[model samples]
Target: MSRPVSTYRVQLTPDFGFAEVAKIAPYLRDLGVSHVYLSPVLQAVPGSLHGYDVVDHSRIRQEFGGAQGFREMAGVLAAHDLAVVVDIVPNHMNTANAQFLSVLEEGAASPYADWFDIEWREGKVIVHRFADDLPQSEHYTVVDWREGPGYRRFFDVSSLIGLRVEDPAVFFATHEVIFWLLDEGLVEGLRIDHPDGLADPRRYLDMLRDRSGGVWTVVEKILIGDERLPDDWACDGTTGYDVLNRVNGLFVDPEGRQPLVALFTAMTGQDADYHAVMARSKRDVIDLFFRSEVERLARVAGASVQDLVDLLVEMPVYRAYVTPGEPVDPVARRIVESAAPNPEIARAVLYGSPEAVVRFQQTCGPVMAKGVEDTALYRWYPLACLNEVGGEPDRFGLSVEDFHDFCAGMRPFTMTTLSTHDTKRSEDVRARLQVLSELPGEWAEAVRGWSRQVSFDPHLDYLAWQTLMAAWPISAERFTDYLLKAAREAKTATSWIAQDHAYEEGLRAFAAKAVELPIGDFTALVDRHAVANSLGQKLVQLMMPGVPDVYQGNERTDFSLVDPDNRRPVSFPCAPNSAWDEAKLQVTTQALRLRRRLGPDAPYEPMAAEGEAAEHAIAFGRGRAVAVATRLPVRLAARGGWGATSLTLPHGSWRDLLTGGLYSGRTPLAHLLSRHPVALLERHDL
Candidate 1:
């Protein structure tokens, strides 16, 4: 089975539709990507930039040029020898979808009633509304959407109703269109979206594999804390957060965790563990944002919803797959038994009915997404790189040995990425922040200076300062928008449902004041460090033992924050304006071409850097290729710039693929890395 040399991820909205993508094929081909990994391309809600809010499964998004356009784009890619791997959202669909509308209009009598995961006994498909204005319709009765199970939703997003993919009927219904595309050779592989939300992910993957004649597939799965993908799932691997987290961990200073944590603790006065904070956040979600889900779980367990919430708060991980008639999954049983058990809920969590298992399993994703990723990540400012979806912010950093262990463990053909549409910050933004871990003294001094100028909640102050620095060249408008969103997501002072006007206003005022401070103080410091880390990390990702993906526009510095912020249009005809950007593009293009030349199934080994400043670089070998990236440049430069350091290259007159220079035997690391801060060297043996 062949894997992609590199994948370019494009978000297909009305602005950049298939026609526009088709125009970029030659550029992608020249840049050396083997496939175009697209965001959800199905029909979505009107004018949705991010297509996760898919409304129709059977049709290509007409808003993004429809099926004809997709066919044209696919033809163009095929002509270039590029494959297509589409993101499929089988976990949920928009509430306004035709099938969902049918369920509302005809209630239980509708043929599509079983298509959704609705609690039929409730007799109401309650949709959560944030705005006061409600559209009165005869289709579905309007009720205050609170926590309880009338209809399953994706996280707290009421508009995205969950699908019952465990049902053979729903599975075939949702996937028929996708398979037809595969048959037509428009799509070569499938990347399943939110497979964790399914009742039985393994079974669904098996079915997809069988249906697609064993075509390549990857899931958008997050593996937390030493968790590996289950051996039984018949797919390639994840869409890359696992590799993202590990590879990114290499650049961070393992020494920064303590000081950052100390600062975070004193500022917030919250010394409780991260898991405890997560537990509290989960309970807060149940009471405030997700009352409907809690009520439904309560109904299934025959207990007060509070009891169910208490039980759920202690869950060790996301819900385990508990198909009825099969023995209870050990992971689920452990979570249930480990918690302070209420007999009624305990029974439901253990040897429960299909409904009970489902209700419990469904609640896990929302709580984890909202309570953990959205909430805790914002508040925990210990090494910002670790605060991402698959990262462990609480942990200091990953050691090279630990990374080697991971490389040895996971499947080699798995996809690896640094940035995606869902990333909280672009990889470059986080890479810049990683420099702060090494500059604790300077950072602390700057933080104290800003503290005198801007009055914010101490907790908010720490977060605000970091957020500003991470995305330094942000526009005033986008900066203000990001600050407000950050404050709410942190839930330290204000929340989405209820804004603390005084608190929010103060934070905004602080943002305005901070924005006036010249970015020069940090600009130079970040520039040197960012360049080293960016090139190093990018080289590591591409040459490492996995299918690396380049999130569109990441070939240059993308200092974007989350969501609408990260979704801005990338100006193409990718002209490298600055020397740094040119270096980034050159490194990216060279590594990608090298990956393509190296073929799919190459092996990996870590190489040692000897002599002074050795600690400030990471070097690895993949087949006939050797990738060397500089780290902690500020520290390395301060320590006399690789004074005596030399990276022992694998023997064979090695040619620099990027600059066409040659190196052999113990080459001085400084001489090799001075020009570009990173190098992709190919042995002439190839």
Candidate 2:
């Protein structure tokens, strides 16, 4: 099980199962990925679109072709020189899981009682159910849906119950099938989903590594600004939200902040301060959705519930990485010391009850997910491109030097991705939106025109305008669904638990009218620049320091918005439908193939550009391979279009893999990028 040079992520559903993946083996190989990264393949709740709601781990999903189908798919991939990397969910499982049902029926007397993270009180387990009248069970006590189940869960999803993988028996039992897959050489790598939710991620990973012979592993860990993965964690590196944010930031303009904020404030009549909006959203979610979780923590820690709530709302990162019995990591200690409203509570979390510390750490991740990524990101999105899972909307851009520093320190085998099953928008859609940061005034005027034609809630209208523009040509139905979801997630005009029917109806009508409005002209205005950004970002992502992953269908221009939309069935064996699509496909293919040749240990050096337009070019080298892409295309065009910019090659003749143009010595940027906005060059001594 060697590390993958790169992976192509496919969202496998009931319709597109292991057999369908096998059909794409030749295409994935031809497209140049070393492996096909499949979403959760374990049996999930029947017909689950995204397989995160796994129901059983002991069997391969029947809908996904079961054991036999998986074997057939693996054989085809192996024949094509491709491998497999599976997304595994160890944190939680669907409540309808057999073991969980047994727990419900037999409680403490059940053979599988220790498998779940349920808290027992007087031999009765409390469970949350959505019923007008609570049903009584001798071994279970049913509570209101709003109450936190007397058990740990994944985020606020009650239907997904947490697993007690900290127990050795539970870990081995749940991972039996996965271990079998590894032994049979059916899977080569593992992508651990939501490691932050684990009671002891470090210990869980240690056990996994010890048992599985340490095949290449990465965690779905979201690192905040300047937050580094703990060196002690037994994994390769993060799934690459850190790299995604930095790469996304390279194309954003810091200068656009003030004007964009002003325009957003005027249009939406909402607070322009991102931090304030996020803080308020955090507080609201705790009260509205996490009251039960807070109550449970308070009862366990003997700390005031309000203090715990305040601390959770203020905590900066997802988890503190407090390992209960072990000494708190310096980083975790510092974060808790800084964020805690009371020093006593901080001490409790740091050196208090093991159960208390673990619960607090688990609670922080859900709060951040529900608060910032889901709520505030939707509420105050002046620039929607910055609203990714681990991105900071207020932080506008990254300096070239800073970006290089970030890349230089990356773990070689760590996964670096621009898009995934979880991204709010696809890479191309964000590329289009990034153009708006450069042309805020034009965007503002277009929004004004659209607003004049059709209007909804101002809070939602601002986000709707951005979404509509980024994913233009989207159907009225698709656009309507996206807006409704955004509005509910924002929890401003409407919410999932509490619906505003009248406002939702208006939003539906608005979507239909807004899509029909004269919006294509505006999209056309930014189309060329957007194309440049798209190619520029794609080339950089594919050639950067880590193992880059191409989300399904993103090798071409994919203008999808959020999930269900982003997860739509991709037509395989795809051909270029347009010039932009062809250009993007060429870039993706050339870069991935070059990376495969370079291997994982190639040295990276920042290649500096000289002359007037030097700032506009981002050039880097990996062994004999070089990647040069234009940044801030609109600004570059405004500043006279790469007049005298030149990059000195590594003292040899070089051929552009993209266009086959030859170059040596001081190559002029204007000539190198004359054909496309990006160039992938290979040094050729001949």
* Residue lDDT tens for model 1, 1-686: 34567789988888999989888889899898899988889889889988989888888899888999899999998898787888899889988778877776677788998888877655666555533554554445555654443677788777888898989899998887798888887887778888877877888998888888888888988878787787789998999998888878888887777777777786667753787777777777766777877777767666777677887777756665677778876765666777635666777766766767767777777787787788878776656667888777877667777877788786877899999888888988888888888887788778777777776677667777777887887666788888788778878789897799988777677778888887557866777788788888898888888788999899877789888888898877687878878888888888888888889767888888998688777788888988888877777877888888898887788999878899999999878976788889999865
Candidate closest to the true structure, highest lDDT: 2
Worst 10 residues of 2 by lDDT: 128-137
Off by over 4 Å in 1: 122-124, 127-141, 147-149, 302-307, 328-336, 339-347
- Go through the candidates in order and give each one's C-alpha lDDT: 0.80, 0.91
**For candidate 1, what is the TM-score?**
0.94
lDDT of 2 by residue, 405-515 (tens): 998899988999999888899999899999988998888888888898888788888889888888988899999999989989999879998999999999999998899
Instruction: Give residue 259's error in model 2 in angstroms.
Output: 0.1
Per-residue error for 264 in candidate 1, Å, reads: 2.5
**What's model 1's overall lDDT?**
0.80
